[model samples]
Structures are given as structure tokens and as C-alpha cells.
Target: MPTEPATYPGYRFPAAVIHHAIWLYHLFSLSLRDIELILAERGVVVSHESIRRWCLRFGTEFAAKLRKRRPRPGDTWHMDEVYLKINGELFYLWRAVDQHGVVLYILVQERRNATAAKRFFKRLLVGLKYKPRKIITDGLRSYGVAQREVLPGVRPRTSRYLNNRAENSHKPTRRRERQMQRFKSPEHAQWFLSAHAMIYGHFRPRRHLMTAGQYRRSRDQALRIWRQETCARVVE
Candidate 1:
């Protein structure tokens, strides 16, 4: 009920079409042109550049609205960082997820030192609105320093195997990275990932734990919610 209030004004294509195009691109390892071709197969006949524009403009808005409908994250958090090579330059991609494997946030920064770690912790606190009861991560000394200064009183579990959830969250991103031929720069990576992480996560609900019937019901529910979130006028 918090989303779905948006209405398409001057857009030529219906909001349904635009939302579906953005969905295809973010939920899978598809490029803009890949989405263009898929839509063409359905007789939509739109250019790749137009789809790109739609995603660039509407994707973030849609993700923000959908997040309003999400459940509160688990109290146990997992944190990890990966090395990203963009434009032949090295950068760190910081990410956090709840114990349930729900992505909390993503950040790109130049350093993995204590300063950068503190910035990431602050961003998470602002977005999540509460400190986690416990955080699991590797024995990165930067996390130790940041936890002392930023997340005081939160329990920190430093181990090699405890944070597999956060580490595995980067797999889909690696596939998308190769497909897009790597991001043009840090801004580009963050822009795409900011939307991709949320939108893609919405329809994905840990299928391995569900029966086929359960998965279908979950997916149907997600799509119904998507229609409610992105469509200016509900379809059928």
C-alpha cells in the first residue's frame, strides 16, 4: 500500500512495458541490447538505447518504492569486500547482508582502510535505522577499528567461514560485470548495482528451500507486488 502511487505522465510506452524491460535487464545477465531483443520477440519493438534510458531513470525509483514493502532485516549482519577493476583502476566494493542473506546496502570506495570502513558503517546505520546485534566478518583489522569507533557495543565475530553469505552475494554481480564488460567507472557501477541489487533481490526468494508450489506462490506474489509498485494503472 505504500508504493504503486506513481503515474506515468508523458511516457510514450505504458508503465507496464517500461517496468518489465527494466526487470529483465536487472534480474538476469542481460545487456540493454539483450533486453531490446527480448522485448522485440514479444513484438514490443523498442530500441536498446531507449530501454537503457528507461532503466537509468526508473530503476532506482522503482527499487526505492519496493524496499518500503520489505520486511525488517535480521539482527545478525554479514559484511564483506571485493576488489573491483574499473577502467584499469583498482577500487573496493563493500557490501553488507543480513543473516537471512538479504542485501542491506552496497558501497564503492577507493580504500579499504579504517576510514572507508567507518564511512560504510555510518551509511548502514543511516539506512537500517538500527545497529545490528552482531556482525560477522573476516579478521580485517579495519573492521575492528571501525567497529570500535562507529558500531560500539555491537558484537563482532571475526572468522574465516562465518561470512559466506556476504561473500557469495558477489557472484551474481561478477556475472553481470563480465556481461556489461565491466563498469565504466565507480559511479556507473554503483548506479547500476544500487538498483540491480534491490530489484533483483525482490523476485529471488531462496528457491532452494521451497517446494515448486511454494516457489510459484512466492513468485506470483512478488509479481503482483511488482505490478502494484511500478504500474501507474494496475493491469488486469
Candidate 2:
């Protein structure tokens, strides 16, 4: 069995274009139409439909590569869930990020309960390859129960201000949701968010903690990692 090749016949946009489109989609809170217009201004006329497809395909691929190359997050993990409405239906997006605000993993589920919490925890453990030392969540009783069963020795911290790190991390995702006018389905939402999380994790530097020199170094390191990953894929 042979894999079918992806065809983009009429327009010969470089990999850079696909990369640029994905970056713009995440970096700025831009819609597909908005991205098309931005690129049009730069003399690259691409349809919104094309841009959307590029985001789904290249965005996911790029994110996967970046995830593979980047360092694993620390043992202190913060978890949170946000509600999203897609086509009048409600769903939850469970996000777990480490101490430095690097996204560890994400899952979209219909409900936020003990079972959902356990499922998320299982996914997190598998993806991260280590049980976190401490887990923080916003007064979610399910987290307390799940942690006891799955990650028994891990300390569970449930407090108002304590979970602010996870709460603050949702801002970029919320901004992106507003630009797209909400997702069409759970599958679409999951795909887009998974890609976005990877892209976000790549570019975002720990600005709050680093000095000016240290910040620049971190920024350079991220870009270096991204370029290396992109080049490796090209070679393969």
C-alpha cells in the first residue's frame, strides 16, 4: 500500500508559508480570514480554506516535532479545565502544564468528574513519563480523589490563588477561540488545541523569571530547537 501525496497544485507556497501561517494563527489572535489578509498584504495570496488546511496539517506536524525535541517538564504540575461551546454543545478542555507554564498535555472530554479526572491523569502520566511531585487544581474534588487513587503519594493542592498559574495559561486559548468564532466539533477543537499547545510551548519564553540576557538566551534556544526540528523533517 502506498501513501497518497498531498497536492497543492495551483499555488506553490513554500514550507515557510505553511510555517508562517501556523505561527500567525497562534502568535496573533487571528482568524483564517485575518491570516489570509495579512499574507495578501505581503504579496502571498492564499485562500482562507487553504490556510485552514495548512494549519491542521502542518501545525500538528510541527507541534509534534517540537514536542519531541523540547525538554520534559518538571515534576510540579498544574491542571485546569475550561468550558467551550461548539455548535451549541458544551465540552471541557483539560490542560496540564508544568511549573514554567510549558504545556504537558491536553484532553477534551464531555464532562469534568472523577472519571474524567482519572482519564486525564492517566493520559498525563503516559505523555509526561513521570508522576508529578505536586498537582494544583482549583478546588476540584475530583482531582483530590483521582490523585489519591492514581498518583497516591503526590501532594494535591486545592486553593484559590494557588491554581492561578493554570488559570492564567488559559488566556491564549480563550483569545484564539474568540478569533475562530468557536470550533465546529469536538474533534476539530481537539486537533486545533493540540497543535496550538505545541506551538505556544515552543515560542513562549519564561519572561516573568528571567533577566534580560537570560530571556534572550531562552528565546534563541527555542528558535534553535524549532529550526533544527524543521530541518530534520525536511531531510527525512
Candidate 3:
């Protein structure tokens, strides 16, 4: 689907600067102040507070645009959940990825029970627009219950050994979580991670599996898409 142009009316900085700040914040482990300094070094004098506002305003918008450009996810889906602490309270971060490590969706919930698993499953089915042929997950009993209720026909494979794809996907989130000193709240974690998954997933081609030439070409293509998506004409 073609993306309609976006406008940055009433903003002091240009859209490119806003996009740059957001991209930097999500694509790397940089604090708001860190991003502010980096932009200043490049002669773009914006405050860290302004950077924070830009991310809150436009990060998900940008992610939606990029997701629209993605191909359909693979038929084999992998799901996993990890505990995240927000304000010293525990929340579950449920994530799903395809066999190729492309993120499907993320949900921040208070429980990792059958209810939560079912909710995540339904969201993924609706979001992805199709049922996956098979779901891979760890030995979470909730998955078995949720699979029956939500996606009965789809095969569910249970075993820790088979779910490395989804588990490995958490590594980047873990890194970013530590870098940011943990999320302030569940809503905060959801927005930041939802954006992170899309942006990071776009550029993170499996270089280990590709030839050097293939990796370069894939990277160049990703860069082109990022440029086009961000630098396109903004309506007034």
C-alpha cells in the first residue's frame, strides 16, 4: 500500500530532523540526552525533551508506514513472553516472530496466563490478517489452552528447544531495556517496543546467513526504504 504523505505543521524542526531524532532513539541504545548531544554535534540544536515528544508523537506513525511495506509474515509463527519490570511492578511482554525473525506483534500485559496468551494470539491473528500454519512456543501450559480456544486448527509445537527464534528476538529488547534503565510503565514499554520491533526488524537482515555481497545489497535496500519513508513530501 502506498503511504499518504505526512505533514509536520506547527513544529519548529523540519520533518527530517524529527524523523532523525526518533530513528536514532529507537534504532540504538541512546538516552534522550545522548540523542540531544548527537544531534547538536551534527549542528541540529534540539532539546532532549523535544526529542522525547517527537518519539511519542511520530514513532508509531513511522512504524505503521514501514509495516505496510512489509511482505506477509511466514506461515510458521513463534511466540514467547518475558517478564518486564515497570516501576518495580511485573508485566509480561508477549512477542511473536516468524521463522525468519521478523517480529509479528508485541503486547504488554499484567499476566502470562491463558487469558494473556489468548489475547496475544487473537491480536496476532487479526494483525497479521491470517492464521499461521503452526505456532512454536516454550512449554507454557497457557499456550496450549490459548491455542485451542483461539487458533484451534493451527498446530502448536511445545518445547524450549524449538523456540530459539522468538527467544533470540528478545535479546535486542533486553539490551535496550538495560540501556534505558528499565521502562517507566507498561504503556511506555509497549509504545517504545512496538516501534523498536518494526524499525529494528526492517534493517536487521540475517547477515550470518548471507554472503557479503548479499548482505551489502540487502542493507542498501533497507537504507533506501528508510530514506524514502522518512524523506517523502510532507503536507503543510
Candidate 3 residue pairs in backbone clash: none
Preferred candidate (TM-score higher): 2 or 3: 3
Q: RMSD for each model, in Å, please?
A: 3.8, 4.6, 3.8
Pairs with steric clashes in candidate 2: none
Which residues of candidate 1, in runs, are more than 4 Å off?
Answer: 1-7, 233-236
Work out the TM-score per prediction: 0.93, 0.88, 0.93
Candidate 2 lDDT over residue span 1-236, tens digit each:
55332323443576567667878887778888999999999998899999988787677888888888878688888999999998898999999988888898889999999999999888877755667789988887998888999999998888878777788888988887887788889998899899898888688877878899999998888877775665422211
Candidate 1, TM-score vs. the true structure? 0.93
Q: What is the per-residue lDDT of model 3 for residues 1-236, given as tens digits with 9 covering 90 to 100?
A: 66535647778677778888888888888899999999899998988989999899888988988998988889999999999999989999999999999998999999998988888888877755678899999998999999999889999899898899999999999999999999988999999999999998898899999999999999999888887877745564
lDDT of each: 0.89, 0.83, 0.89
Q: So what's the TM-score on candidate 3?
A: 0.93
By TM-score rank, best first, the candidates go 1, 3, 2
lDDT of 1 by residue, 44-70 (tens): 899999998999899999999888888
